[model samples]
Target chain A: MKTTFSLALAGMLLSTTAALADTTITIESWRNDDLTVWQQKIIPAFEKEHPDIKVKFVPSAPTEYNAALNSKLDAGTAGDLITCRPFDASLALFKKGQLADLSDMKIMSNFSDVAKAAWQTDDAKHTFCVPMASVIHGFIYNKDAFKDVGIDAAPKTVDEFYADLDKIKKDGSYTPLDMGTHDQWEAATMGYENIGPTYWDGEKGRKAVIAGTEKLTDPQFVEPFKQLVKWTDYMGDGYKAQTYPDSQNLFTLGRAAIYPAGSWEISVFEKQADFKMGAFPPPVQKAGDQCYISDQPDHALGLNAASKHKDAAMTFLKWVGSQEFAQIYGNALPGFFPLTKEKVTIKDPLANEFLSWRQSCKPTMRYTYQILSRGTPNLENALWAASANVMNKTETPEQAAEELQKGLASWYEPQQK
Target chain B: MAQDRKPVRWHVGVFLAPAVIVYTAIMIVPLFATLDLSLYEVRDKVAAFVGLGNFAKLFGDPNWSGQFWNALWNNTWFFVVNMAVQNPIGIGLAALLSSNRLRFAAAYRTAIFVPTILSFVIVGFVWKLILSPLWGIAPDLLKSVGLRHWFAPWLGDPHTALTTIALISVWQFIGIPMMLIYAALLSIPEEVIEAAEMDGITGMSQFWRIKLPLILPSIGIISILTFVGNFNAFDLIYVAQGALAGPDFSTDILGTFLYRTFFGFQLQLGDPNMGATIATVMFAIILVGVCVYLFGIQRRLRRYQF
Candidate 1:
């Protein structure tokens, strides 16, 4: 009996010591192709820095991310640190007291005010996340394809842009603008993220719409959507049949002149495209209009309020905003535009070109699904459907615009009470 | 009477308890719970009772009815296509394979059944690539046959997208009906065929008069199964077209609609109550279909002992 008791005590002591030696901090994020790089390079560097804490990443596909996160958070089975988009989804969690307040952290000093404000809760006081990166939404074009079509330079005005498209269309050798609306979201992505700012008069107009003070069907918004329909001609007959990946391949293979895509695609383009690639801001509304790029923060890291390892998780969150982590991020996936105020040089030329928009042009807020409230008709979804309807000639621009207004009203009017 | 009376069969209840408990826990309980939730609306993360408001919105409100009706019609079209194309083709293949004189019958049967065993993801992606105009073999094959001009992007066009997906589903699942019908054909006694032969009914006539009638019950069974399966279908369309059911939402179906509502997409928040409402509606649809078959059709279709 004494021997058994002694053995039990020894086993307990060994297990306790092993547990004390390493603390695991779990992070939840959407699965990306860069995940392998993150696992190999990022996690190891962090582990090396803090020997007492081990980090593990939990990932779900983009489609499944929100649903999986919601269930996990509700069940209190979520990771120590969670990845969420800025504004609403994170704000919802914050309101429910699911996230820890990070306003007092010294590490947050690395972020710009704009970056910090993007993830702030409603009171604009406490922050729930460390902003990681922001992507510039714009057009990715084949520089060589433009030259082949006898176009010497990227368009600076709306008419010049249309003229370039016509030139490529007249050449009859390649598709002018490569986009596949088969998945349907691409149309909205192009409309709202890439081109909407140019017509909505940039960030101020967007803030107005989000504030519900300005209507979506106003003349300013309507004009851009009307202009949006003209590109249907350049998309070719297979545009409806075209999937996003198909367009990517078309652009990469030099089969298309220009592709409207986000900065996130830079890494893939650099690896795949054999020809010279360049990026340009969506053309200005008139000859003298200053160009703007939709700069938006991506997945931000937040601490789970229910986490057992609160100290370890906080330590990891602080390290995330550090320059060491930024260097690791730059080396592993240079395409992502880092959000830190520190000077981190990127080596990828295409990435640099996309970032150049930051220097030369005004930065505007990008459209996010987060603006639409939960449990209401989604304005973003309605806009996507309406845009597709316009392209298909099923709905006039007026009708589509009205439909959006109605959807917004459905959500907005109810909340007024 | 006292001698004939058996003691209470407590063992029978004991034997049935596990299955009943499991079924009640997993299926019946969830089903009832979903039905109960349909009458509520979730606002700001709290569920408030709204009665038939969701259903009214689904059927009557302009914002939702368009999508709801589109999905319903598409689902109906999907069911019709399967019944019209999948069943007849399955019957024909089954009849051919059941022939006693046919050589390598087992191999042919196995070859035809291969696609049924494949998952929806594999089938969706494979068909997507095969039908893709960019890097697909389809356009090339058509060109070789001098039918290149006839080739169109079937999956991309709003008019043909749902039909194309349905036909692809038919191609993958045709083996199910074929196998079931084949089994039914084989179960026919040799004496019955011999007797029919003696009566001068041979080959096509013999099949029409004898074999086809024997398999009516099986055909009815296959039809109802196809209905339920098609109405509840989701994965194929999702893997192929995504939740938007794009090219102007031409391929939207009830299953996808339910999924989009329940889980939410893009900016829309997930509403469990509304999802429950959609599920309850789906249950009613399936229940009505099953009842009509059970009472209206099956009662008249004879399952002959011979």
Candidate 2:
């Protein structure tokens, strides 16, 4: 191993003395204790294998990850291999031609079919990205909490869901639903991005909107907002007081009987001392129980298009594609669900159930707020404001919908000018 | 002519040259380049001159007008909270601790100053978690008293989000101006204070009449600095809230708005042209603020050298 390692390094370093010596391979990898541990222990093995190449790690916090990466790209100092989020912003970068296409890499064939479809352009000849891990976000319920309230399991219809929530409250549970409108977008995230399109974009509704045949003021959009208000109202008074983590914490601590959130958060609840938490598909409508569940491609990654060291970059990305490495990585990552054929055995039965249950879902549609909703920055800002406004009653759902259409008209009309 | 030749102002220019070059290259050039970039439209990898179009869109166009006004309004409130809360608190602490009789004053100053040393990201997350209902010490502290009911998740609430963040910022930054004003307050000649004491002006009276007059310039300087730093600030709000400034964007300031516009989040493409326009507007806002302080406020206030 040393002979193989030393030879590779010695060749890379000596073969290109001055020119290649300066060509340092910079990797803008994420900072995770587990991932860092792997980088520290395993990367040196790769480095030892290739001596001429020296790796410089530019570690950034998760919050600063996108901004820092953007600054680096703007300055043209962005490194060879960078982590990519699956959000619409990444698509914006792809349009800018900033991302490297590694479609030709044999390792790409190993990607999950869903993962491949999400990252690649319509022309399968190009693949601009890969994923960190498969992130599964769906509605999760506490089975024990339900049983205590005399409900056996999750409801298949919207009516049964509300009935179960009522039962929980009737049983003297403080709050049946932990819908935290304190973060306004959480309401829309649950009401719209995760579910609205499930029905809105479905056969009858989408055509109406697309044909300009349906005003957003039409009951289609208004009904969801009203539904959201009702669901939120069930949380009792002082609803404005709830925060995201606060609601999640309440459910985990058993202060609340039920919660709606992403499956990615299962590991966080599992750390609680008591009670079992499990995942379920989004609540179905009694009128349309036969509709499909909305889903999206989760936690994806991509390579930099302008990377100087494509071979080494390809090697690293290739490792990410391997099911064995992905399984090892995902198991250690806690909340992540790897999309490889080889399953990493999860310790939490609830988390395992979520991963297994998700196989049947048909993703509703893919439009993160930042991307799909309103395209203009100012309009996006308004739409976001409207979410909070609806909760506060400062703006009605009809007003909110009008504001969005007006926002689009403002941008579109001006661009025409 | 040879004998009349001036000595080549040797060391000053020589010493200044490197710094001047570096500063001009790093700061001034980039600043002006950004301003110049504001006047152009991007197409086919080339920038075509578009006189005041970006500015027109930012200020005049209805599409952008609301967001611009909202951000401006939020930014104004964000700065006002700091001036009202951070500056006065800092000044008071500096004045109190400057008294020679105060015991363990050095320790107090260090303890107060330590938060300033933390990065914004750290402070944002630390305060966010601390104020959290889960794993937070703030709730427990409040619960210890009868005030547990008042323990709302401040950071996550839209109505209170920006104001809550402003206070956290003040807590982190109070040390900077505290140390500045403390030094200014300490440098006042002892003879002047002694005279005031002899004249029967003492304690609170002496501070108001004697100490504050002398430290007016320092206050003005700290004010301008707070204005500049607050106006330019992005990290604190950004970390506590995502780029979207969640909970309905109740916390969108010029900095975040500028960032989202320039960098393009979600579906929005990063428009260097528009970003430059936002930056120029910021520069104008900051310039007006500094000018008002220097020419207007400072001129009106008499700095008594007693």
Best by DockQ: 1
The global Cα lDDT (0 to 1) of model 1 is: 0.83
Q: Please list the residue runs of candidate 1 whose C-alpha ends up more than 4 Å from where it truly belongs after superposition.
A: A1-17, A368-370, A373-375, A414-417, B1-5, B51-53
True contacts kept of each: 0.45, 0.27
TM-scores, one per candidate: 0.93, 0.81
Chain A TM per candidate, in order of listing: 0.91, 0.77
lDDT of 1 by residue, A1-417 (tens): 999999999999989667756779899998566778778988888888788789898788776677678778888899999986767878878878998888999989999888877689766788889988877888888898888888888888889989999999999888988887677677777754578888776777777776766787888777766776888889855576777889888888889988888888887888888999888888897888888888877778999999999888888888889987776686577567778999888888888888888887788866544465443556666777777667666678888888777777776753232
What is the C-alpha lDDT profile of model 1 across B1-306, one tens digit per residue?
899999999999999999999999999999899989999886776778888998997788776788888888999999999999999999999999999889999999999999999999999999888888877778889999999887777887789999999999999999999999999999999999999999999999988999999999999999999999999999999999888776677899999888888877755656677778788888899999999999999999987886
Check candidate 1 and list the clashing pairs: none
Taken over the whole model, the C-alpha lDDT of each candidate is 0.83, 0.71
**After aligning candidate 1 to the native by TM-score, how far in Å is the CA of B37 from where it should be?**
2.7
